[model samples]
Target: MNRLRANDWLFWGSVLACYLLQLMPLPQALLPLKPWWLALVLMYWILEAPDYVSLGRAFVLGLVGDVLAGELLGEQALRLCVACFILMRFRARLRFFPMWQQALAALALLANDRIVLFAIRAVSGEAAVPASYWLAPLTGMIAWPWVFLLLDDARARARVRES
Candidate 1:
């Protein structure tokens, strides 16, 4: 029970951290390179602990992210729901893949996220995004292994402490 509680704390703490990262300011040159931190973090959770992350939760998180980033009210929510749905649908296969394979899958997911965002903006009459807008998913792909390892290590430590 204690271990479960600790895991809960860790999950929320990581979510908070991802939100902070999303809100962090960056130079104009690097802004487009910023990966979707919340999406990546939520993907990790959805893949590792499906019971704890659902489509509704993803929608809520994306709504919060939309407010934080000052995007359209439902834009992030829609994007996140789509991403979560895909992840949940393929969780079984994704969970069993090697780390490198998982990272590739992450790349595909992030790219799909970009497509969703594009559709949302298009429907909303937003101006065309620059080529750089696509770079974040590549960066996310690069970061996936590190993010997975870091979170896995943290979870392991929490379990160890409980033991």
Candidate 2:
């Protein structure tokens, strides 16, 4: 039988925390700048723990995210699934990228994410959003390095404690 690790709490905790962050209130003006916390968290796991997090797992979390955001059902699910699929296909190249380059990859992924959402909204004939809406992914990209480091450190510490 495969051994299960003892640091499960850390993984779940970080994921939950990201979801909670996604739900946090912000000023109306600041809403446009709120990064996709859940996506960033998902990207980390997709890169660092691919064995544990896969496309199906991303889709479920995306479903939860769709509900959390009160969006059209399956919007986030389809978006996240696509992102995860792309990431999984490119994992070999991305996983080895230096932190800076990884952040670039994150920026690209998030931009692609926005494009996917835009297409969906456009298809559904949703109202146009302000130009500021496009900037949120930039903030997410800028924060990627820090988020990566913090979670990676936490994972390392969690594993050490487990050992």
Candidate 3:
């Protein structure tokens, strides 16, 4: 309802901030450590606001990510749609998983997403990927718990405000 709508806005707004963080200029040495913020944010919404983020919304957001990052066309959109689809399909079990398990699952999801990107790059005959491509997901995994806790706290506050 209205409360959920308000919360959804908060979620999307935070996701936007994450994208900005992702795009912030940084030295090459630190780039691999940049967590996949958009994926984490989207996964949270997919878990916490399933009714708010659907396949269509995921697709659109992914398209924007693709354009923003200047990646191959449709690569991110497809990966995002697939990730969101899996998250939506398994959300019931995902929601009940312990925080450690949830972080593990998020790591797997991020790794899979990266693999998909690699596959797309290979298919497109892009340059060889460095071993560093694996680093982002690890960083993302490490960041998942923190991101989840922060978002959960934000959502709780939003819920309280609504009530």
Q: Is candidate 2 or candidate 3 better by lDDT?
A: 3
TM-score of each: 0.97, 0.93, 0.93
lDDT of 2 by residue, 1-163 (tens): 1123544666678778988988899999888888888888878888888876788888898999888889998999999898889888998899899988999998899999999999999999996977997998899999999999998888777666656
Please identify model 3 stretches exceeding 4 Å from their true place. Answer: none
Q: Candidate 2: which stretches are off by over 4 Å?
A: 1-5
Q: What's the distance in Å from true for residue 23, model 3?
A: 0.5
RMSD in order of candidates: 0.9, 1.8, 1.4
Give residue 73's lDDT in candidate 2 (0 to 100). 89
Best by lDDT: 1
lDDT of 3 by residue, 1-163 (tens): 8777878778778878988997998997998788788888888878887776888988888889889999887887899898898898889999999999999998899999888888888889985988988888888888998888888888898889889
lDDT of 1 by residue, 17-70 (tens): 999998899998999999988878887898887777888988998898889889
Cα lDDT listed for each candidate = 0.89, 0.85, 0.86
Better of 1 and 2 by lDDT: 1
